[model samples]
Target: MRNQLAISSLMGLALLAQTPIGQAASNLVFCAEGSPAGFDIAQYTSGTDNDAAEPIYNRLTEFEAGGTAVVPALATRWEVSPDGLTYTFHLREGVKFHSNKAFTPSRNFNADDVLFTFNRMLDKAHPFRVAYPTEFPYFTSMGLDQNIKSVEKRDPLTVVFTLNKVDAAFIQNIAMNFASILSAEYAEQLLASGTVRDINMQPIGTGPFVFQRYQKDAQIRYKGNKDFWAPERVKIDQLIFSINTDASVRIQKLRKNECLVTLNPRPADLPALKADKQLQVIEQAGFNLGYITYNVRKKPLDNLQVRQALDMAVDKKAIVDAVYQGAGQLATNGMPPTQWSYDDSIKDAPYNPDKARQMLRDAGVKEGTELTLWAMPVQRPYNPNAKLMAEMLQSDWAKVGIKARIVSYEWGEYLKRSKNGEHDISLIGWTGDNGDPDNWLGTLYSCASIGGNNYSMWCDEKYDALIKAAVASSDRSQRSELYKQAQHYLKQQVPITPIAHSTVNQPLRASVQGFRVSPFGRNNFSGVSLAE
Candidate 1:
């Protein structure tokens, strides 16, 4: 029998064969809580729902995911101009969609759908236009509509994008599943109606699955698109995504054969899972990092000394071991080891309670000063017990004469409070959108960027300049150098302390095959199935 592969090891899948039988014969059922935050690919704003969105929608291009190759999805091939400013995509011909009630044999896949998708992203008049908050900085970091001068449909199978400035990573950005193509017909319908209810509940795409029904938190289902371009390779007939966020409920279901797969397993559940001879527990590092964020615009945190004091005081390794049960690795500085941009030269803050005490004293953090820390009621991304983690920090900081209060809010309310920059400190984490460093640094730290994700209000002009220079450069060597400099500066500033680089923990039944993990914490559900 072949050795069981770690989720991360699946990234280098050169030997995996394509099979017609696999796509038609297999059926896999899984579970996740709630539909993705939203579903319009253009206005599809949140990171959580790609599990359902990715297989239903396809991008012009695809990143090799865990590996280094740039694989083609919708676009058969593409070319970056010599200056790296223009990208022309040569679309594949004869690609048809799964038959739908609205359209049969799906109209020929063409540039018009591609044109509508990009234009919708840049259209300020659209209702969903407000979905992309100006506070999320990477919109400009990737230089979206601002850098693109025009997108012309060269032919039915060709589309060209002209940029205001050279963007070396423009092609990679397109690989973002968020850029999934939408039918011009469907887009027009949406434009006329001004509501996403129909599309979100029932989406259309050129990928492996066709939407069947969405029962809100109860379940979401999709039928295999046998006529899909890669039908033979997909090997799955149906998908059932169930909602089971409660760890105990999920684990019980997994053991009873109620679920074929599960994610974000609790630490206590690991031993029992591992001991279960009938089931398999696969472990790998996740791409997420747990960290504390301070409102730089707010008092106390505005002072670098207080931020550094909090950074120095906390015991990251202890938290990792006790809170996470050694499931995750420790973070050094701000970079994850899995990322190409991580600089080994950058080091984590030493855990010294005394140093934290001295720094707090220097900042005049009085004994009675109550610092409130914010977190969501349910654990997310890293440190499954974010509320508990906050409480731990509160106790630790108290030893250093800082009175910290831990607060929990619902996910939506927590997000709202953080965005308004009202918290003394908030516990947060991020999963990298792609391999690029800008997803973390540039998107979160750029100066007062519109739609900026950097809610901490941390800004450094020099750091911003380096990120700009890196993106603007088509030269690989020069761009890398610029990124290195930006990382170096980021370490010195100590905006958010680096937590551990996360490992993907996706436990599947032995019958489930072709399961793989993407850096973005998404599943390529098209290739997954129950081995018959």
Candidate 2:
């Protein structure tokens, strides 16, 4: 029952230690759910990437650990233009970037570093992006280039961003994983030597931790940045991200104290974790959503009636109860209720098999119609068990005279293939990168995300315009109304059917201290310390 809210008192006693106590072991091992796709969070959308990036880099602004409140991070403070189209950030002084065997930083973080980070994203012709042409799913998929007009350095410690139009969530967006600042000097060195690919393997940043090495899909190691700009240095000397795909293996490792912490412990294992006096569990309302997307470009799914039919035929309530094991709630709308301006009033499609059959019949999708359902390989905050969900969907769909072919690939391959439009209907979702409605609506459903996040390929001018108008205005009331209307449009379109938002549960050993689960579903070890 002890969660993040109860950890404040425990933290007060050990807040002074910049290293672990009693055991002579300053290292904190984490049983990460999955390996990061790459260190470049700007280029990926999965939480695995965020988990790795959060410790290695800092953003201008950040969502507080275990909370959604935006706080000053790399940039001490910022100013917004009157028209809300421009933002100026004051970078913190004397913040040193991490130095390792791969690359060394000759100077501290400054405006030039900030310029390199944003410019590489905003400018396709920039040498960094051009030299290392990796896919930027969260950036390009979110239509950032269209929103951000330019990024320029005002001085050594000041950076200014000019937007094409007003975007109320701009600051929160900057706090996202994709906005993690990189050392421009490091990029230049790598690009000049034709070893730019090392930037993805070895990251150099101004965060509290330093990236040591990453053994693909196995382990990612880090050490504390002693010269971090923050007043208090990182409590843990070293951090290890142990990539283990099996939930049971992770829990076993946690119980044995092999790793001080484990991410996303299966809901079924919560009882044993809480009962064991040596272990402690953290639980909170997750700011996330899980959904099933019917790739409408495919046969039968091309019909709106068929999409709706598929939506109505699947019993979400059954899947939530069975697969989640009491860890989640049936999704109300496309986004979780935690998102600001989220339209909680909108409900998912009513489960009516009779009506679904009729709808499919009207669309000329006869009985015994066959289609593929792509499941997810790894468990996530939004979806703990994609294969189970797919099976449940298969059963529900079978009752409606549809033959479903279930398929899946490795986690990384699954995302790549899904984005490439390789499936009929796929299981996918999001843990809001930023605490903004635009992070959900505009990033996931907008036509601009067609080749990336919007795998369903649902594009409509009305939906896009409403989202555009919502972001253009700084008025909360106006934006709320626009978001509500957009939600109705999303439900009408039937591109994706919302599933559930899970209550994220993480388990840590009693020796571990100061660890908390992020509402945004990220893992942070900057403040963590291990004790005997």
TM-scores, in order shown? 0.87, 0.94
lDDT of 1 by residue, 322-440 (tens): 76876778877555767675677877677888988888778877766887888655545565777677778888888788888878765545655676677878887777776776666
Backbone clashes in candidate 1 total 26
Across residues 372-461, which tens digit of lDDT does each residue of candidate 2 receive?
A: 899988889888889999999999999898999999998888988898889999999898877788889998999888877998988889
Candidate 2 clashes between residue pairs 3 or more apart in a chain or in different chains: none
- Each prediction's whole-model lDDT (CA): 0.69, 0.84
Per-prediction tally of clashes: 26, 0
Candidate 2, poorest ten consecutive residues by summed lDDT: 12-21
Model 1 reaches what TM-score against the true structure?
0.87
